[model samples]
Target chain A: MVHALGEIHRVLASGGVLIDLRPLCDRWSIEVFSARETRHTGHITDLPPGLEDDTAANRAMHQAEINGWFIREKEAFFPLHYVWDTASDMEKWIDEEWVDFVGLDEETRRATRSTWALGDADSRVRVKVKMLLTRYRAIK
Target chain B: MSARKDPEGNETKHLHQFADFAGKRVLEIGCGEGRLTWRYASASALTVGLDPDKNALRVARIDRPSDLADKVHFINSHAETIPFHKETFDIALLAWSL
Candidate 1:
């Protein structure tokens, strides 16, 4: 990851900007909602590898700043929500894409399905992820 | 299953505030399927989206806007080794791929 950061610095023009945007290594708050109401299921924590990688990413960025490759700047947090029409659809998508990083435990699955059953066709499943968006200015 | 992401456009709005994509050369790393590339690629002079996932790159190429044929490109590569000379891009965006 540090090598990637250095390569980013190498390829950027003087005074150019490097945007570091990613999800924080924390619990993902899962929610089931419909047109009229919403319910919050328990959060899902990231797997060991995902947690380790994000921690390393932070260290790499700090090293980049200390090396004077880029100057750290403003950063803010935002919620990035992924919504699916049904709980099963959400399960399938996550199983396919994020299975290695996150898992839908039996308890959470039950909660999601229960909350979803309360609504009509309007019910939707959501995974709300906290994202960290920050920028760095390349050093000349 | 169909999935809708970021319905509020918060990511786009924040991106616009943080970096002006207008007429700039942009490098987007880990640009999975270009789902986020289209958000700002329209405003950029040139965009090169790099990712190691060939399937995702193929999808990105197929789904790219017709008008951006010349402005946007997808590459199968790794972020550790950007395939370009020094000082090649005005902005490098690492979105969830670091």
Candidate 2:
């Protein structure tokens, strides 16, 4: 990643800017679950359970490393939501769009399905993902 | 311009505030299927969309708009090794590439 940043810096013209929008490695900020059996629940918090502190630490390390070559201009956070019309849509997204999130064991998959199950097969499901946005200038 | 709605699309508004490519040369890395090339190509003098995925590039080429045929070009290449001279482009957009 550092090398790629360096290459980008090298390729940019003087004073050229680099906009980076990446997922925050920290714990998710929100989780919403809705089902026919249970009432809709929207869990919004500063951090989610089972998230290790090391994830944020690693992200900071990466940002600092990039700052060594590029000048930090701005940073912000935003929520990106994905809405699936059906369970199959969600499954396909997890399998295709999000390759890294796939390949879980059957038990884990079942647990995830239960967690995100909707009112019916055609019901809507939404997942809110938090992202970090940073703008940097290539140091000439 | 309503930031409250379509927050993901609002990111582009922020990016535009930081960089404007009117009449400038632009290079986009990992430009999958030229999803964004059509958006900014009209404002740029030359826009090169590069990606390592041949299949995506093939689709991009086939979908190239006739009006943008002269302004937009697609290249099959990786971001690590951009096939262009140093300082060749006035702007380099990664736009969700990273």
Candidate 3:
């Protein structure tokens, strides 16, 4: 979160306006994703089926938390947008689905640039989705 | 369940500690999920909740209390790049986010 805020500060003009949102005790329930429509889903392969990572949302809120350096704006209430048209469109959940995090036995870890690579690269899949939209702002 | 995390479950008691929010602009840093945003908004302050985790913010926005919707602002931005200038807010509340 701190790394994200530094980027925002880099671009924001001095004395800019910022509105932020933070969660105290919150958890997210990701809707599951699969290549097939509930075909008795199972961990057939080490790789997850699709792409899911909401880095953009994290960047936004992280910037908001550092409002101490900026001029605070009128506090407004905005909710996150959680509805995506389809399952494949939900990108936030893709990382957990696609990445095979199993510990490398030995030779496999040295064979590739990523320690999390799948045992069978042929079965790997990558997909994107918009799981949610959060509200945040920092204006110069 | 949301109200349970309040500094004190009782609104009146928490309000006493948060009296700085009265008619002031408030920025809540590290609001895990805006559980307090709902209460602070109802207490007569314009409050904003700032969190970096989108997964958590997703639920915060989904279940925000409807009654205080107009009084608060939920932003997906970070604590540093807040859209405002320095010294702009009357009060900044960070509940155990150190």
Candidate 4:
């Protein structure tokens, strides 16, 4: 994509502003995708935990990698947080809306649901990200 | 060992190996609970501490030293994009921030 953009910019007018914006959302975005049942019960936090915490390091590395791609005119960070409080909120919406779904046993679902209620899922399910937005200008 | 003393009798190791910190803008990128933020605030008059987690920021602000807290500003933000003027910070400490 970077190569394609560079090639396109080569033919553009002398002063062209190339604004590239992409959400740096990670796997935790799934919290918003949980079923209504999971949502109401706060079971959405049942998502598997990451092996390593990659928040700080990943952000830095991503910025460095993108900087390598093009000449950055300006760079900024925007922080955001998304939260879903209950299992039913997630389970109802997801289960009813989807045509195909995977079924879990009542016991397992109950266990997961309880875990979310304890607030353990707050950090486990929610993802706070700093969106690194950079505006780059082609250097001829 | 440096021989720098605060209002108290405690001696601080002034890292003169670096430039002056008094009245200079500073940024504590990580600032986990203001452990080092308080340390730096003791010397520098103007310092800002940033962290993404609100809970951590609360702890840093509350438990931080009163003397240092007066000089430090705590903000809930990430390191990737610092919310300040460019080249505003003379000394940005990243104690375990990376």
Candidate 5:
């Protein structure tokens, strides 16, 4: 990650800005059933069952570690909600995009399907993703 | 289960607050399918979208709007080894790349 930052620093011109947007380490949590239900039940804090590396934590640590190379000018948190047309779509995304994570078991999938079912019998799942937006200036 | 709607234009809204691309040369690394390119390409003087994924670049090229044909250019490249010369672009945007 530091190497990538160095490459970015190298490519940036003087006074150039680097917009580093990534998932915040400790801020990531999944609310599987429903917004209200998840809110009342509390978010799942544990890392997904099969993830080998702590990506969010590593990203946070990387940001701290690379602070010296670039000067942070602004920072904010953004909420990104990834909504799927159906529970199957959500499962496909998890299977393909999030191959590293393994906690999406049958029980969770079933709950998501049921929770996202519409009155008209439509099924749509929404996943909440938290992103950290940081703007940095390359230190000459 | 209840139906849910996808979030609308949140990224663009956030991006507008952070930087202005007017008349600036922009280089977007890891630009998958040019999702954000079309949003700012018109405002930017010149926009170059680069990604290592050939398939994604192909999709981006096919989807390129006629108005932005001259303004935006898609290239296949990696972030670690950018092909352009030093100081080529005024603003380098990674957007969700990193």
Candidate 6:
């Protein structure tokens, strides 16, 4: 990953910007929401292989800065929502795509569905993804 | 089991806070299916979206907007060994791939 950062440094013009955006290796909040309100359902932890991947990515970015390839400029945290049309839809998707690390066991599934039931017809269940959006300046 | 991501447009909005895309050359690394690439490509003078996944690249090509046909291009490559000359882009965005 550090190698990739170095390559990015190489391709960018002098003082060009490098933007790194990715999900944080932490728990995601499951919620039921509409335009008016949001209710927290449960938290789903980002698990093993994926957690390790993101952690390594964080370390690599720090290493790249340490190497003086790029100067850290600014960063922000934002909530990225992955919305599902229905509670079951989210469960099914998680079973296939995120089962490796996302902990959506029977209890979490129940909690999410319970919250989904309390919302209006327009309500949807979503995973609130925590994201780190950082920009750096290439030190050419 | 399809899910809509970033319906609030926060990703693009937050990205805009970091840099201005208007008329600049941009490179998006690991631009899977060109999801984020399409969000900001129209503002760029030139945008290149590259990924090692050929299947994803194929999808990105298929999904690319018609107007961006001249403005954006997809490359089948990896970030570790980017196939480009030095100082090729004004901004390199590692969108959810770093």
Q: What is the interface RMSD of each candidate, in Å?
A: 1.1, 5.9, 12.2, 19.1, 3.9, 0.7
> Please, what are the lDDT tens digits per residue for candidate 4 over residues A13-95?
34333333223424222332233333322222222222122343345434534655335566554544333355454344435
**Model 1 TM-score on chain A:** 0.93
For model 3 the TM-score comes to 0.37
Q: Which ranges in model 1 have alpha carbons more than 4 Å from their true place?
A: none
* Candidate 1 lDDT (Cα, 0 to 1): 0.90
Error of 4 at B32 (Å): 1.5
Error of 3 at B25 (Å): 1.1
Please state the CAPRI-style docking class of candidate 1.
medium
**Lowest lDDT 10-residue stretch of candidate 4 chain B:** B1-10
Q: What does candidate 6's lDDT look like per residue over A1-140, in tens digits?
A: 99999999999999999999998857888988888888888888667987888889889989999999989989899999999989999999888888876767678888888878877889899998999999999998
The model with the greater DockQ, 5 or 6, is 6
Summarize candidate 1's per-residue lDDT along B1-98 as a digit string, tens digits.
87888887888888888999999999999998998899999999999999999999999999998999999999999998899999999999998887
List, residue by residue over B1-98, the lDDT tens digit for candidate 6: 79999988998899999999999999999998998998889999999998999999999999988988998999998898999999999999998888
Q: What would the DockQ be for model 6?
A: 0.90
DockQ of each: 0.79, 0.30, 0.04, 0.02, 0.45, 0.90
Give, for candidate 6 chain B, the lowest lDDT window spanning 10 residues: B32-41
For model 2, residues A36-69, the per-residue Cα lDDT tens digits are 4432333322333223333543364367455765
Best by DockQ: 6
Pairs that collide, model 6: none
Q: For every model shown, what is its TM-score relative to the native structure?
A: 0.94, 0.70, 0.37, 0.36, 0.78, 0.95
lDDT of all the models against the reference? 0.90, 0.62, 0.43, 0.46, 0.67, 0.90
lDDT by residue (tens digit), candidate 2, B3-92 = 122335655565566668799888887788986677678888998988889999999989998998998999988777776666677777
Question: Candidate 3, after superposition: displacement of residue A111 in Å?
Answer: 49
- What is the C-alpha lDDT profile of model 3 across B1-98, one tens digit per residue? 01112222443343334244467666666776776666656665577777878887788878777876787777776765676654455545544242
DockQ, candidate 4, vs. native dimer: 0.02
Off by over 4 Å in 4: A1-140, B1-19
- Deviating ranges (above 4 Å) for candidate 5: A24-68, A118-123, B1-6
Off by over 4 Å in 2: A25-68, A102-123, B1-8
Better of 4 and 6 by TM-score: 6
